[model samples]
Target chain A: MNVAKRNNVTVTGQRGAPVVMLAHGFGCDQNMWRLVVPALAEHFEVVLFDYVGAGRSDLSAWSEERYASLDGYARDVVEICRELDLRDVTFVGHSVSSMIGVLAAAREPGRFARLVLVTPSPRYIDDGDYRGGFSKADIEELLESLDANYLGWSATMAPLIMGNPDRPELGQELTNSFCATDPDVARVFAHATFLSDNRADLAAVAVPTLILECTQDFIAPREVGAYVHAAIPGSTLVTLDATGHCPQLSAPEATAQAILSFTGAAP
Target chain B: MCRTEQEQEPERAGGDGSLTQDAAFTALLEDSAVDLYENAPCGYLSTLLDGKIAKINSTLLAWLGYTREQVVGRMSFTDLLTVGGRLYHETHYAPLLRMRGEISGIAFDLRAADGSRLPVLVTSAVKTGTDGQPLLIRTSVFDARDRRAYESELLRARKEAEEARREAEEARLRAERERERLQNVLVTLQRSLLPPVLPEIPGLETSAHYHTASPDRLGGDFYDLFSLGDGRWGFFLGDVCGKGPAAAAMTSLTRYSLRAAAIHDPDPVTVLTTLNTVLLERYTGREPRFCTVVFGVLEPEGEGFTLTLASGGHPPALLLRAGGGAEYLPTPGGVLVGVLPHPPFTRTSTVLSPGDTVLMYTDGLTEARVDSGRALFGDGALLDFAARLAPATAKDTITAVTGLLHGFGDGLDDDTATMAFGVPASGAAGKPA
Candidate 1:
């Protein structure tokens, strides 16, 4: 098994510098970090990869039995790091991947040096006093929403959005290839991401951690971010001025600045 | 009349009439342009880069149950979406639009002012400025109530089809397993109708083979060699008519009846007569069962064997001579057993010298098709084949005949049974004669 090819791992930046591996959450691929990669690349060795079943990764490697839970995704991360022999790495995860990094770091503590969780949520559904920010019915409605947008990931609608005749150059880079995943794989990943409760996994994080939260995010509310920060001992929390759950796209500069400052790589 | 006269007076003043017509046409065109934008069938909107609603047509406002004052500059696009739709828009829709600069035909449900959900299909494009810099976004919304209903119906139908296909595959597998189990049972029953191993006579060598054409149906051919008593052996080979369970039942009765009769009376003719009586009494009905058999008694006579054979409509036995020749021991005038109460049976006697063998068989061998099913391997061919194997030992002859049967391949479509017995020559203990 070629782990790099299976996960679509892309390595860039100074070859010998400190490694910063970015793991994307559900719904999108490593292309979600396109805006933040340039700034991070100049100071450190930046690694980008799409989890199996997302982006241009080998989708055949995906199995419903393995990917039905977050453990399967964490295995993908562990294998990629082992394949590259990465050491003392800075792991940055967005959305649900924040907990995925916690799992990977706990499994192989020596491989990861620091962890950066962006708009993180350990759990999506609200518990009694924890307030993870959603109801059980809302998650069911989210699955319904995924079914309604089945055409959005289908080939028919992808070409319409990707093929820009007026701007032919834009069509070159964005060719029917953006978030188009297999519908079955997408459904399983949705179930894994929205229904999972990983609050217990946070206490096992022993590495230095930084939590980046957006000021106003509906998916991962500020309370959820505070919960994640308090759960992990000695973790730093920084709130960006961005509005949505994805600060890397909404505020790329601030997102990169916070990551570089935590790693002490910014000159 | 007064209106018609007044209308015609304007046309008479043609120079002024042209100016008046131009003014009315310009007024109509101006009114239509504004009306088309405000009252188009679909809704339209433009938003800033952050999705703040900058401009919205009246048609979309009416669909949302929001007035122009409440919508513009007050709520972003996500505010109009349902909770699930908002998460989808932020996580998937907006990210895709940011990467591709445009996205279309994405399904989302919008929350109206009264908290009702309205399913809609949205297409949005980024409006860049002259310097290729960032700008606002233009969007179009189409009501998708009917299309959503149709799509859900298609999804449900697809699920049902998959379920039906899985069930059909399971049924086919179950039927295959059942057929295998039945074939196993038939094979076990077929073995029970024959001797487990041929009895070893004092001064003779014997071998037998049975070829079944199909495993699914039980074959009716049976052969056995059993000791009667006082240095005498009773042997028989026969085939019951028809195939399957009915013929199989009759074959079982015929084999046991022949054995019991031989014990009572070792004479070949008497043993066959008793079997005939037993079959006729038990299976005489609308679908009458019958069989053809050759029963024989063999006893050692001065270093060789004297075989007394009786046939009831069965094919004659082949005798291979020690002097390199073969011929059938004819038993003429025999009628089929069990069909009549007093049917005549033919009886014959033959002396087997040193190294001479007698082979008895069912008609399935001689009747096998040959030459690509264009001809039958008849009695003449069997005689010729036996002549080639003349002066051969019993085991060698049976092996050669089994090879010949296999050579028929698919042409041999019936069950065949062959049994051979011979006395060894002087200087060749177990070698072929």
Candidate 2:
């Protein structure tokens, strides 16, 4: 597939501006960036896209073998850059997408110049030596809840934790999109996200990175953000006053300012 | 109307009789409303915006065996759930209710006063004020012991279904193993039906090859050369009508009958004629068997071998002469054996000089498909091939023909049988010495 169509890529910014590719997390589509994209689009060329199984992407292109791991997602990132001939790209990834950027940049460090990780966690379950802030049984219960209600659990859980009841549109939109994802794809994606162990992949990230850590995030806790910052070379960690995992929704202005500040100071 | 004391009491209490009746009715209605809420069959509770219990009914209190004072203002709705249920309530139930403004039919287990778990289905809604701000949450609880028991039945059925699927898989695998074992048996059977080893013929170099298309069944093609007494030898190649166990039986009968009949006469025509009579008598049943064959008798001569061959609906033998000439030794007026009671058979006579090869093959080679299944390797191609290999030895001719068959690849789909005989030249002389 052509690069633009495969990931539902949409490029909009100044003609000669640097490319800012925004990759959304697992639960929602590219609509996850609706609040943050408007500000970033003015200063840099912002690229928004949905993963293959999440939004208006071509589902026929999905193969169980090809998408069995996160490496396939990284391959998509590399191909998108190659297809568009994008150089010195600034990749911004949220939740599970953050590690996807880390993996892509590690493989092709020449293509990327900066990495911005929003609520990133290399692993969710805690092992003996490392503290990922969640137990195995906790994750199993989360999966069982997903199996029981699919979108009902995430759509409702995301908004309450995200805490934007004043704006009902955000929660309602998320609920509809939760059911919109193919349940099979969502289940596989959950396994890839929560069961992955990519702590070693952080050392190979040569590009300057910015980690956006939010307060009170039940998904990726504050310690995970610190662990990511310590592992990535020459990486900066910015703890936002935003309360939830998605600062882009709960606190869009702060999220935008932090990103703009990082890119300006990164070079 | 009867001036009863109960009726007069209301009039006595208030100077206006209608006012007294209104006062009495108001007290009665207020008492009934509170009683209905307290003793309703289901449980009812209200929580603050922060999930702290603000008001609870006596019915829910009775189900939990908790006093109203102990539950109210002390515990949130999540605190009343079991440990696992609490996690679910905090993660999914509460979030969904807050975002959607309501949730219904959620299954949860509430920890009772004595720590026994009570299964309940809860429905909750967020209460909003005139300004559309959520003030509190109102929840109704229903006992779901029966529903829980019923849903567990599906689990049992699912386990049974899983067990059934595994057994079906095992049966399929067993069937596959049986098929493999049958193929092995057929391979051994097919090997035994062919000649154990080609008999050594003095003064004549001989070689033969057989190819079967698939491993699952035995081919009908057969060839053998056996010695006849006093410097004479009998050789034959034939293809039975069909394949498999039945065809193999017919082949064994024909091979043994030819050997027996040839021993009695040794002439090519008499040997085939004797075998034909036996087959006609044996196969006269409803399902008859027939074949095409070329039987030959060879006699030692000075610096050469003389061959007399008889045909029954078979291709003529090809002669690769020592002088580099190759052609078919035509034998005419032949018919298929065992089908007719008096099938006319014909014979041909030829001589194999030193370094000359006589090649006989079943129709499998000449009639095979060669060019991308688009055309057959017909009689013309075989003629050209024999001419190319003129003056070749028996071993060399057989080897070259096998190579040609291998090159046919996917196009050659049938089994083939071929045999060649040659008289070797003496050293220091290419021609007969």
Candidate 3:
């Protein structure tokens, strides 16, 4: 565990660019941003770290009672930024961590200057007035698949969750990040990610936020991006041309440019 | 009245009887026709070939929200149909009626009193005079709302049943795929615990076989033969009690411990004792596990070999001699390996002469149930089997036994594992002859 942390994160490019903190979705750790790093690193300061029960972090530290809600993960993002004493931070999050970063930035508004959310979905289940694209039956299908096959579920569910597999190798490396964690940890995170609902917290985020929505993303539909834009007072909403859940891996250059533009950093 | 009396010429003269009767009958028929037309069970009407209303009944007028005078010479039959129905009648019903001189049982919708659609079945026939010239058309209409509703319901229920059947088929396919996946895992795991092929000992004729009753569930029987020390070898055959993943785990544990213990001490009896201790230590309390194992150490002597055999509540090994007879090797007072702290394991010595074979098997073979009477193949049957194949080599003996096991049909319910060893005659080593 110590050795993995000792291998310092590989940060490229000139150091003057604003440091961007990259956080991962559930069932994945920091390694998911590996493919996106080479493209963004040339113009930004990149920071990556594993959530406590993920990647190479110590597994003994995980407690069901503590990490039951995503608040525990949200605090860790804020703590990492505070430990480094970073300013004007641009926090980029994928899936559930998108809102995690939102909660963290809302707590310490001065620490982060901007937020970039990719394939962000605030709620997975449907509400009375909102359609999150998943039904109660669809969630049960996802649960059965998780119960049956955990090791290869990302591979099986990627094309379904991504909404487009014809391009191929979309999110393949990001899914490999899932394999690096223990299977048991992946199971717990899968439950936590799909069951969380945080639509109400979008209004609390005070940073200048830009949500990167894939036009045909099965995870977060275009309408959901509009919902986020509607709730977050002055947040910018931009739609990517790509059609998968993880457009960061599908079209990294476009995603990197969007993140750079949102932070007001010269790309 | 005065003119009628004068015109009534000669009321005498038999009174043209036939003519009076015809006049009275014709008057009665005309009255009945008018009554039936006004109160018929179904709507009845006649239209010209051009579809102009020439005659209509009271019932037909009431159904169409029109009075008899309003429709009798004003509207056409097609005007009473809905838009699509009118189009269908124009394109299909009119052309077919012209050719066939009649059309019947055509389903259609008609505009009703409240401007709502009333589903109806209609039959129309074109009338022709005796001169072969077309005249007016007679049409009959019946209410069909009940039948239409019933047909729609039946179609809906049939569609729902088909969807249910498709879902069941998909679930069955998923279940089959899951079973295949588990079987593949079990086969791979089962292979890992046993040797692909037994080690080729110089003077020993050895062969082993494992038969799985089900591919998806793992069998608890296992066997292996490997070199122990300088010219001394060790082999063991054992059967755990249960089935499924738990038994598979025990099989793996027993196999690894036997190999590890044999490497620690070359003695077969001591290795079996060590495995007993391991099993006792690991699974002694709740849900304790036990197996019946036979461990043997074969040492080379002069022309042939001698073996030291120990039994842990397992079946007695059978020895077949070259003299065309077989006997059971005695290892008495043995108990199951993991049940007690210090279970007594009995050891015995036996020599393999030229063309002599020894067989070891699990109880799955002998205890196989036969018929409804619950008769078992039993120890007697196995002994008889061995005696019948007295002069056979180890390979032939195993081949014969496996064939016999296959012949048990439905009797053999559990998995079977058998191991046999023999010493070839010095001259006939290469060929069966």
Candidate 4:
């Protein structure tokens, strides 16, 4: 089925170098890693891809029964790795994708070498005293937020947002078409992301893992980072001096430097 | 008052009056610019690139119920929103505005200072510096209390319409299933009223066919050939007055009574007289049930069969001879069964030599509509059809008549039943041709 085209896979940097696959989280596409790609690509082969139902990937491949759970997304990751015949690779995931990588690596341990989880949460809602940094009602509020921005993701506004033909300069600035997706597809992805609890799955990680946490992230607080680090034995947790959940965009240099040091790719 | 002063000054000193008017106009313009920014109809706010509120107009402040000192520097734009709105701003709104440089007509609800939600539509644009770098964000907010209420009402009505359409589709499917089930029951009942297979008569060729016009309604035509005793047989063909379950019930009664009466007395006239008494005793009310029937008895006699037949207001039986001739055996002055106390049934006799056949049928054949429903096929057409098949065996004659009936197509709108029997010609005797 052409896995590379279905997932919009793009490969760059030096050929024959060690491979580093970057996976984006919910709400945005692979363009979220654009800021940190150049630095990582200098020493390693960098790979970026959008999940099905996001970015320019084929939307027709999406089905509600298949994509209703995180396992479907994990299957996409495993298939993409198999399609490329990648071996001993390092995987970087953001937000909900961090859990997805854990699932993929566990299924095909031979394909992946190391894991990097950026501002991830094993669970978003508070369970017992775990302090996942949100209540059950708060996640429902996030679903309402998705509905409130219905007009933004509608097809009528997509062309205007993706390419401003009236102003060519604006079009040049928006080369990647960031964060625009079908509203129905986005809703299902949001439900799978925010409601999933992967606490038990974290113990199955067998590779060297690095968990990067932002100092003031409301979506994934420092507590969730510590929980993920403690759940995986011999995992290192590094707190970046950033304010938002997306440290790759907010603090790209530090995010890339941490990855380069862990993989021994930096000169 | 100003107009009166200007008019008097123009007459006294025209040059000084023009200079005073220009000075007053400049003062009015300066005052209005500042007032318009503070009290515009919609709210306006400007924020830093990171969403920290840098400046806000007084009209927006009044709607938020916050003083200038409390909000100007202490809160970011996300802080003023509800929990849901903050998530939306991070995931969809901020990322889009950063990429597109401008976004318009997005719905959001801001939590006011008193814990109330104020629905509003927001439009934002990035204000760039001279070097083509983003400096700050400029936002305009419009109150949407009335619009949101109207939108919810429209959404509710549309949902109701979709649900009703789904229910109607389900109802139509259920009714179709019910009709199919009823048709199955009618077909099974119709089979019970006819014999599964006709009995084989020794040394005689026999064949019968029954055609029903509608699957939904049970046809009332019936025919049977059964042995009466040693070297003799009794047979009958009839049609009840109507169709469906009521006619089917009357047909069942008529068939059983004729069989029982023939067992008691194999005489064709006496058997019919007994059936007439049984039907009249059973069905005699405002809606009297009656039928036209022909009964006959056959016995072997010197290389042929002797046939004695009686009619009760039924169509005359047709005879085809080995000598290449065909004609009807008329039994006149007969009355319909179940309609009178002592109706006289007419009796007749004929001999079937080798290859000679006698055929009994209901009026459904002659009464069939033809010529685009303009006229009936009539008794004359039946005689012509029988004559064409003269000198033919019993089975061959029946097959030819069946084909002619099929040619009528939709014109054959009633149920029909036909039975034929004869002695085989010469060497063909005792073996089917």
Model with the higher lDDT, candidate 3 or 4 = 4
Q: Report the first chain's TM-score for all candidates.
A: 0.91, 0.87, 0.82, 0.92
Residue A4 alpha-carbon offset, candidate 4, angstroms = 5.0
Model 2 lDDT at residue B187:
79
Q: Rank the candidates by TM-score, best first.
A: 1, 4, 2, 3
**Cα lDDT for residue B51, candidate 1:** 76
Per-residue lDDT of model 1, residues A224-255, tens digit only: 98998999999999999988888998899999
Q: Any idea how many clashes model 2 has?
A: 0
Q: RMSD to native for every prediction?
A: 5.2, 12.0, 23.0, 6.1
The DockQ of each candidate is 0.58, 0.06, 0.01, 0.41
Each model's lDDT comes to: 0.87, 0.79, 0.75, 0.84
Q: Candidate 3, which segments miss by more than 4 Å at Cα? A: A1-267, B1-30, B45-56, B67-103, B126-137, B426-433
Better of 1 and 3 by DockQ: 1
lDDT tens digits by residue: candidate 4, A34-59 = 87999988888998888888875767
DockQ-superior candidate, 1 or 2: 1
By TM-score, the best candidate is: 1
Q: Give candidate 4 misplaced runs (Cα > 4 Å).
A: A1-24, A28-62, A79-89, A106-110, A133-148, A152-186, A248-262, B1-35, B130-133, B194-433
Off by over 4 Å in 1: A127-130, A135-137, A148-175, B1-36, B130-133, B195-206, B227-233, B263-266, B284-287, B298-306, B320-325, B335-337, B352-357, B369-377, B385-411, B422-433
Alpha-carbon DockQ of candidate 4: 0.41
Error of 1 at B12 (Å): 9.8
Best prediction by DockQ: 1
Error of 3 at B185 (Å): 2.8
Q: Positional deviation of B200 in candidate 1, in angstroms? A: 5.4
lDDT of 3 at A77: 77
